[model samples]
Target: MLKVCHMTSVHKRYDGRILKKECVSLVNAGYDVTLIVTDNKEDEIYRGVKITSIDFHPKNRLDRILNSKKRMLKKALNIDADVYHFHDPELIPVGIILHNKGKKVIYDSHEDFVQDIKEKVWIPNCIRIVLSFLFKYYEKISAKNFDMIITVTPHIVDKFLNYHRNVHMITNYPVVNFEDRKNNKRSDCNQICFTGLISPLWEHENIIKALNIMKKDDISYTLAGPSDEDYIKKLKDLDVNKRIKYMGVVDAIGVDIIQTHSVAGMAILKYSQTVGGKIGTLGNTKIFEYMYSQIPVICSDFVLWKEIIDKWKCGICVNPNDIDSISKAITFLKNNKLEAKTMGENGRRAVIQEYNWETQEKKLLALYAQIAGERVL
Candidate 1:
């Protein structure tokens, strides 16, 4: 069996994309996979993938770049696997080092780092510009050394293609299994749901503020997944009649429950074209999850995202920043339950037919095949 080592300095060991999808898929495909992550601990096996660690969690952003990089690199070198896959922008140098040791290094680009840096609110305006330029150059220079580049969306692929030829577009689509949820009908549910990174990048506040605009006592909102402690406090202080409830960090089944119970899903990424802003147009996994759960969606009005929503006819794409648009969409979905139900079914059908992880699985295995010399590179 080919030994594969996946590394991450940021996300936890069982992160959805790294563990649930990629590592698990590799194991099913007959590769011996091991994931290297932070938190120095003994290695163990979870779902046939070995999990190892560096036992390091930095206090701040600066520590991750200034300190965690070296320690994680040392752990990676000690693993000595045939193929090294790393996630995290700061690990670009780590990937290069492994590549120099003659290992097939694959860089997983999940986000546009340069864009993210451009939108970082904490960084000084002058410094943010400098950091964005430095990171843009560094990302390109480091990515060119990798054997292959695995990207989560076409947008990221477009960015990476300018740097490297071997770019694989493997989206972070949900594990499309809607058979069990087919018979589970929920017609009049008034709950709206959102799970995943509940941060400013995801426009968490936008979702809450939209709900605030629609003063419907009957409607309730459920949010799961971890967010900053300070942000959590801020949301708690919102006088939204205690209708907005945060369920804290939830597991896979927990997230599914929220989606199933919700009448409509919220995926309102903030509309921003600034340098470090979040890529609002990429594949938002939560939308697909809501579809798989058979529900209408209220998402941002980005051109790429609107096109998908229009093609599927499953939800309303609104100006996320426009309180009236979001409020109107939700109010419509709540009042016109039948229309919302139809939209939900259309979304589920779309997920079952095309936007499923199983389809992306083929792309992933094909990339590994090329790596293993089982197919032409």
Candidate 2:
């Protein structure tokens, strides 16, 4: 079997995109896949992929950026795999070194890191642009040395094509099997749902404010994801009625259960051009997740998302920051239950037809085969 080693210093061992989708697909395709991650757990085989733990988890952001990648590089070199696939931008140096040594190196650009750097709250506003420019230059130069570049969206691919000749877009779509979570049990449900990273990046406060604007005693909103205490407190203070429940760090099955009881799924992100606000720039996976769960969606009115909503009629697209717009959308879905159900079915059909991991998996395997210069399986 072809040997493949995937590495990441920031994401968890079983990150949805990395392990559940990419590594698992490679393993099933008959590749000897191994993942190196920054976890404390013992190395073990999970889903036919070897899990090698770094054990020394970084203490903070600085520690991770400065040291974690170094440890990851050490472990990667020891593996001596045929292909080195890395997931984080900080691993660019590692990828460069591997490429210099004539190893097949693939950099998976999960998002537009240059654009993402501008939105990072931790970075000083004055230096954010300068850092973005410098990194953009660095990434452009380094990317050419890699054998292949994999990106998530077409926008990202277009951006990277300016950097490297070999760029492929493989979206982070939900697995088709998630359609199994849907049922006829949500007819009388009055809850709105969101399950993913809960931070300032998304308009969580707007959702709570919209619920307040509705002033309906029966309706409730529930969200589950990893978040900080200060932000969570801020949301709790805004939610005086306790209608919003935060289930901290829910697993996949937990997400299924939450979506199973929800009337509509919320992906109302804050609008900003620098932070994935443009059309075709962002492929918000939650929209597809909600579709697969058979729930109507209430997401941002970005052109990228609006096109999908317009085509599929899966849910409502509103200016996420506008309280009245969001409230009106909630009311429409709640009052017209049959229409909402039909919208949910339309979304599910859309996913079954195109927006799915199975479709992306074929592309990923084809890319790998090209990189390896032979059929992967």
Which candidate has the top score in TM-score? 2
Best by lDDT: 2
Overall lDDT per candidate, in order of appearance: 0.81, 0.86
Over the full model, what C-alpha lDDT does candidate 2 score relative to the true structure?
0.86
CA displacement after TM-score superposition, residue 135 of candidate 2 (Å): 0.7
Among residues 3 or more apart in sequence or in different chains, the pairs in candidate 1 whose N, CA or C atoms overlap within 3 Å are 39-55, 39-56, 40-54, 40-55, 115-276, 118-275, 118-276, 119-276
RMSD (Cα, Å) for all candidates, in order, is 2.6, 2.1
Cα lDDT of model 2 by residue, 89-123, tens digit: 99999999988887899999887788888878888
Candidate 1 per-residue lDDT, tens place, 1-377, comes to: 78899999888887889999999999999998999888766778989999987878778777877888788788777777888888888888888888888889899878777877878888898999999999888888887689999887667787889979999888878886545657446675878888878887666676677778777596887889888888888876773777778899998788777787777999887766531233454545877888888889898777766777899999999876787788788889989888888999999888898888899889998888889883123
- Lowest-sum lDDT 10-residue window in model 2: 273-282
